[model samples]
Target: MAEILAFAGSNSSTSINYELVKYTASLIENHKVQTLDMARYPFPMYSADEEKQKGFSNSLIEFKGYIQQSQGLILSVNEHNGNPSGYFKNLLDWLSRLERRFLEDTTVFLMAASPGKRGGIGAMGVVQDILPRFGAEIASTFSLPSFGQVFANGEIIDQTLKEQHSEALDIFLQKLN
Candidate 1:
């Protein structure tokens, strides 16, 4: 089984993206999947001055270590005004500072979800473009639109969405080996 790391990009306590990560992690019981709570690993705002002053924190090192140990990632990102949340973007900045290719050789099962009709497509588009800069290869992608209407009770309620999720998961798993 692949060593998979899963996390949502939002720090909100009631994050719907977190729900999406949890649900996706559940479907891959056969794999050794580790889930991270982003709220617990919050990093300071990224700035060149801060980097020069303090260097990488222990939490940042630990987070980068997790990515290094994983063969695959199941990341669900949240959108804020058509871009990824600032919190997640900050974390990525720190991770990159530690090593530009911190996610080197990792296969990512990218995901995004939103309560809006477009899901988190805008943020997903940006993420899809940037993750490769950190050495992550896109394995597959799944987006959940109108999250409240389609997902609930710890699962995807809509049949068509459920099938699409399964297919995406399958594509990701195939790349692990």
Candidate 2:
């Protein structure tokens, strides 16, 4: 079975992005999905000086190891003022320093969700452009706007949105196989 890494780019305890990631990951069949909670793996803010004094943190290294072992990744991002959440950006910054090609050749299913009408497109766009530079092969991209209105009870409430999400999952799964 294919192994997939699923995570949301936020650290909030009740992160809507995290719920979105989990819901999407569940759509995959015959795969082992590993969910990553950014809140659980907090790290020191990234800095060149800090890296010089202290080597990569154990948590960061462990997280990268998981990425290396996974066949594909499903990432749902949260936006904070038209940018990636600090927690997710910090993690990505640190990981890039450790391995320039951190996501090299890995298939990625990129997604974003928010309560706002634009969803988390701001953060999603940033990742869409930058992740490829780190060698990510994006297989699909989906954005769920106005997440609070579209999602209910841990699933997408809007039938139309749910169908689109399912289609996205099919694309992701096809790429995996």
Candidate 3:
């Protein structure tokens, strides 16, 4: 079984993306999944000067270590004004500086969820474009729209969305195996 690292893009304690990812993680059988909270990794805003002066923080190093140890990634990103959240973008920046190929040799299962009708597809699109540069091979993508209406008790409630989510996840797991 492959080591899979899962995490959501937001730092919010009540992030809907986190809830979605957590539920998705539970659905995986046979694989070893490690889910993380971005709040646990508090990196300073990325800047050339910050890198030159202090180098990477312990939290960033630990986060990168998880990536290095994992062969697969399950990521759920939140949106901010039709773009990936700034917190997530900044984390990517810091990790990229630490190592340009942070996600090298790993396949990513990308996902997003939002209360809105579009879900977080805008953020998902931005992430889809960016992660490959860090060496992530995107395996599949899923978006759960209207999170409150569709998800409950750590499961996808809507039958159609559940089927779609299952298919996407099955494809990703198949690629990993």
Candidate 4:
């Protein structure tokens, strides 16, 4: 079976972005989805000094392994101050240190969502702009606005939003095949 790595960019225990990623993974067919929590695979706050002093951590090695082993990715990021949350940014930094094109040619389905109307669009914009540089073949992207109103029972509830999300997921899955 094809494998997909699904993750949220937030370390919050009750992360809505995590819920969104899990829900998105559920929509995929014939794929084994491994849901990754940034909190579980913790990494230190990245810095050039830290890299010079200690080199890459074991967690970062394993994290890169997960990315390399998977054929596809489903990710939803949380926004903080109009950017990706700090922990998520740190993960990216560590990953870059390990391999510049870690996500090269990997199919990616990117998403973002929030309680408000803009949905985590700011963070989503950042990921969309940067992932391609890592050689990510972005298959489709979705941003869910007013997440509290549109999502419930572990799934997207609003009809129009659900349809739109489903369309994007279908496009992503098609590209995976």
Q: Candidate 1: worst 10 consecutive residues by lDDT? A: 22-31
Evaluated at residue 32, the lDDT of candidate 3 is 99
Where's the lowest-lDDT run of ten residues in candidate 3? 37-46
- Candidate 1 residues lying further than 4 Å off, grouped into runs, are none
- Model 1, span 1-177: residue lDDT tens: 789999999999889999999999999966899999888887889999999999889999999999999999999999999999999899999998899999899999999999999999999999999999999999999999999999989999999999999999999999997
lDDT of all predictions, in order shown? 0.94, 0.91, 0.94, 0.90
TM-score per candidate, in order? Answer: 0.98, 0.97, 0.98, 0.96
Residue 73, candidate 4: Cα error in Å is: 0.3
lDDT of 3 by residue, 13-115 (tens): 9999999889889999999999998877777899999899999899889899999999999999999999999899999999998899899999999999999
Ranking by TM-score: 3, 1, 2, 4
Q: After best superposition, candidate 3 residue 59: deviation in angstroms?
A: 0.6
Cand. 4 Cα-lDDT: 0.90
Query: Which regions of candidate 2 are displaced past 4 Å?
Result: none
Q: Which ten residues in a row have the lowest lDDT in candidate 2?
A: 21-30
Range of the 10 consecutive residues with the lowest summed lDDT in candidate 4? 35-44
For residue 74, model 3's alpha carbon misses the true position, in angstroms, by 0.3
User: Which of candidates 1 and 4 is the stronger one according to TM-score?
Assistant: 1
